[model samples]
Target: MRQNTTPRGLVQAALAMTLVGTLTAVSAAIARYPVYGGQAVRYAVAAVILLAVARFGDRSRASRPRPRLTVREWSLVAALAATGLAGFNVCVVEGTRYTTPAMIGTVVGAVPVLLAVVAPLMERRRPAPRLVVAAMIVTLGATAANGLGGGSLQGLLLALGALAGEMAFSLLAVPLLPKLGPMRVSAYSAAAATPMLLVVGLLVDGTAVVRIPTAGEAAGFAYLVIVVTVGAFLLWYDALGRIGADRAGLFAGLIPVSAVATTMVLGLGRPSAAELVGALLVGCGVAAGLGRRVRRPAPVIAVTPGRESVRVAEASRP
Candidate 1:
């Protein structure tokens, strides 16, 4: 595990929150357009942008031989594309059709809890007590923050589907990190998922797949493509490399808070007192869960050419 805190890691966390924040705003566009078609367009745009960057943006990367994935790695990448990109978008878009974005956001806040449970099982170890407690606290806070809002049974079930997709996507990607690095993993996953989404969109949305989006819808779709899909995924994977998935997952607790703030900004409504209280609990729980006591490094002894060895203290963890 990475022992030191990093500015990049913090930025990744912020980007993750930003990604979630975009979901509510993007829901407006999804509502305006066909769900599968909108998603297909967004992913296709993002895939093209990412692939272009990967292939020709930097001279050194362009010159290096492209990284080849083993059959197993390729299989994992396919799974990541399916569950994380295509499946997640489809589920979220469909779920939002029957439920409010706030409710969906609240449901997604369970991701950290799912990760806390699954990460230990994947590693063949018992779950940490503190992590378990933190997960529970986060869940409670998320539920309260959303006021336990009611939605249709189908909507709730679909929201759960999205949750499952998200959990699977995250867990599956962890094992592939060493082979493909974050950007390649994200770029390839997006590219792989684009064709799948296009096929699905054609089948489900019919000729609506070819419809052009309005100015507002286009703006929302662009944000979803550039900021949420590409930028957020890259930042998330990068942070996962630095902090390990378990700790990085806990940052998901911020999603509901961001969603609520986004809602208010859109003039939806102010947060209720309970929601404010819940947001505070979420903040505290996330801090407690992620907090670690850094171990001091052993002092190093330097050997000078003609002098006695000198002891020097190493830099502390940030």
Candidate 2:
């Protein structure tokens, strides 16, 4: 059994969270283009990268042990890939096509809030009242930040669907994290998304991703698939393993902040003062919910031959 955790774990977790946030922001930027095929593109790239990594780094199946997920677990993985990869892509892409990329960014930014509210439900755990209050506050902020309550009701609804799909991905993926190592899970998840992407690509792009994609576009797609999807998962899972799920989850709140920062750097969309404030509120809510009090492990009391040793229980925040 592992005896101790270290500072490296925390560093890895922070880096992973930041990278995920950056990549998501990048995805938002280039969301135009026939990238209507994000699910396929993401999976195709991810499969290639991960299959390579698995082969080179740890090809010994016996040493590592072959995955032994039950049928239910496999089903959950499929559902996670479909909802997180396919559903989010399809909804966000369609929403972008119908409305604007800026709007999509704003909508997607609300994912942390959705995850915060949905997490307890997935774990079959009752949430503290603070979590509920935080979620409500964040929801209100997101509504205002996205201008979702204003015009473009159709696009807003589509964005909401995308958020729901993402929440499903987060909740569904939780149980699988313990069984499938994060890298393996990501590889399989991407593999699961391949067929869906292929089907959509044939119908939408028609061999165009290879034929028409500029070098930069291809690079972007590759980055999304291999680096963002695969690398991000590996780092994220490592962090989650070291820190408990709740603490690991709080980092996700940084995604929208990263998105807005990227947008500002690109000079694409100038986030309004109100939008910034809204993002802050939403982020605060997400962190608050994910910060549900961590119950520390009880201390061990040692009994000597003639005496009992009193050990004080120490609470450690994950």
Candidate 3:
């Protein structure tokens, strides 16, 4: 079943990160809106769009019986909505109040290393040393790109929470991706997150929880719905399914890198020499980690009655 799909997966991962990076600028328009309410609207619209596309885009595929989600899958879907979607957004918004956005972003940059170690554990495999080293290099690159920024202890703690949420975003989705596929997983998670955010909006903001957005806010929501939520979520989950999470996590460094590039392009700020160095390191790390991986042959076991079993590695494929 496996083929030369890594290159395509890499491209998808990179594109997804780049799109997400642009949100640093795009989200500005919605800053004045109610946080939970705005998020609710974004997910609601995104879920609708994804459902339509996934349901109708291909006639043959659409005609096939829709796969039923198991109880475990439903639980995973709920957890994803809670931690990755709602919880992550809450941490970020609250984190920025206590810490500089740079600090929060830099903290989240550590996700590469976190995923390198944790993802393999989730898969019940030993984490590869090469991948771990590469993850460290990527984290370093992320730090250089974002630069060290000051924040309170509480801010630091909140940033750490954001990091955990970001990691959960990938780790939680790994199991579901293979079965539900990217489209359903993304659509389902977005749909699940919608009500949670809406209820939070209601409790927190009262009757004014949702207001008619201004033109700028509307435009921002449009980008978020179509590009950030729909496009990025689909591409990210698709890449995760294709390439596996540890390798895919490395591309997350591109998020801050891409954000910095966007700033430079818009004349918001010129990147420093350190930022340039950071970008280079990210490229190098990704290259090293992705070096042609050979799937190890499975082990064979022999059992005879009244004798100790024998286990040995199978011969490698030519």
Candidate 4:
């Protein structure tokens, strides 16, 4: 049986991509701050906010006691914190220092491709042929849109690190989402990462953490904390729950497309011909990857006592 895609899942995926893509510009704006310091501050704030919401804000869920994480579950949360939140942010921030935003965007766009490959291994089954083809197309489009230029060797390596971290983040959280739900998973992951980020920031950057951010940096930081870290993580994980990781992962292709559009909106850069073509390809790939095959109802055969079987066709349900 084919899996069905829902509008809610699609909207969640789009919102996730938009929120994450906006981070490209946010990162650029705040690049001057020490890498660990900026990320630590951003995530620390996000963690606090998410924890508050998880604890006090959901009146509808207030009756239910919060679920406590078992040792095994805590271990998974710790892993997610390390790979997805803290490690991913660190790599991305450090990578931006050495590389252009476009380069980083291009590399990050490969996430879906990595997920497509890894999902099967984790699930112990082969991916569908269409998924593989769609992943390849998305990769090609992302590369074309974000041209491979203006980045150092160190930057490229760091970007690869970021890619690995992100892939781990997405794949690792899938199993946990069903048990904990998206909000709890996100809150715990952020909470776990926050202290680690703070410690790293203090150890690496020292007094920089105390220094006040400039107006633009402050704005960017707010966006990252509120939108990218909290909002995006919740939406993405929720979409993963609704659609499953294999389908949800395909939305990663939209990140670069959204990033380029964001850049243009910010008057930072214009899309080139290659980027335009690449955007089209990404749209096509996502549509194909998420498209569901409609199954026709099987013909009902009535067995008769006398002789022949009568075939009856049932009308398709809406």
**Candidate 4 segments whose C-alpha is farther than 4 A from its true place:** 1-4, 57-59, 96-103, 150-156, 294-318
Q: By summed lDDT, which 10 consecutive residues of candidate 1 come out lowest?
A: 1-10
lDDT of 1 at 25: 51
Count of backbone clashes for each model? 0, 0, 0, 0
Point out where model 1 deviates above 4 Å.
1-7, 96-104, 151-156, 294-318
- Taken over the whole model, the C-alpha lDDT of each candidate is 0.76, 0.65, 0.88, 0.81
Q: State residue 306's C-alpha deviation in candidate 2, in Å.
A: 16
Candidate 4 lDDT, 193-264, residue by residue in tens: 878887888877786764689998899899998889889999998888777677777888777788889999
TM-score between model 1 and native: 0.84
TM-score of each: 0.84, 0.74, 0.90, 0.85
In model 3, state the lDDT of residue 51: 88
Q: Could you give candidate 2's per-residue lDDT for residues 1-318 as a string of tens digits?
A: 121235555556556766666675566535555664555666777877887776665666648766688999989878977777787777876786567655765566555445545665656766546656665666655555655433277787777788777666556766777767667777787888888766776787787643445666677777776667787777876665665344444555555555566677877778888779877886676556545465767665545666576656554544
Model 3 lDDT tens row, 193-237? 999988888888988889999999999999999999999999999
Q: Write model 1 residue lDDT over 1-318, tens digit each, in one string.
A: 342357678668657766766586557765768777777777778878877776774555656677788899899889888888788878777887788766776787788788888887887888777777887787778777766566798889878888887887678887877667677778888878878888888888777775877888888887888888888888888787776666677777777777778888888889889889878988887777777745677665566788886767675544
**Poorest 10 consecutive residues by lDDT, candidate 3:** 1-10
TM-score-wise, the better of 2 and 4 is: 4
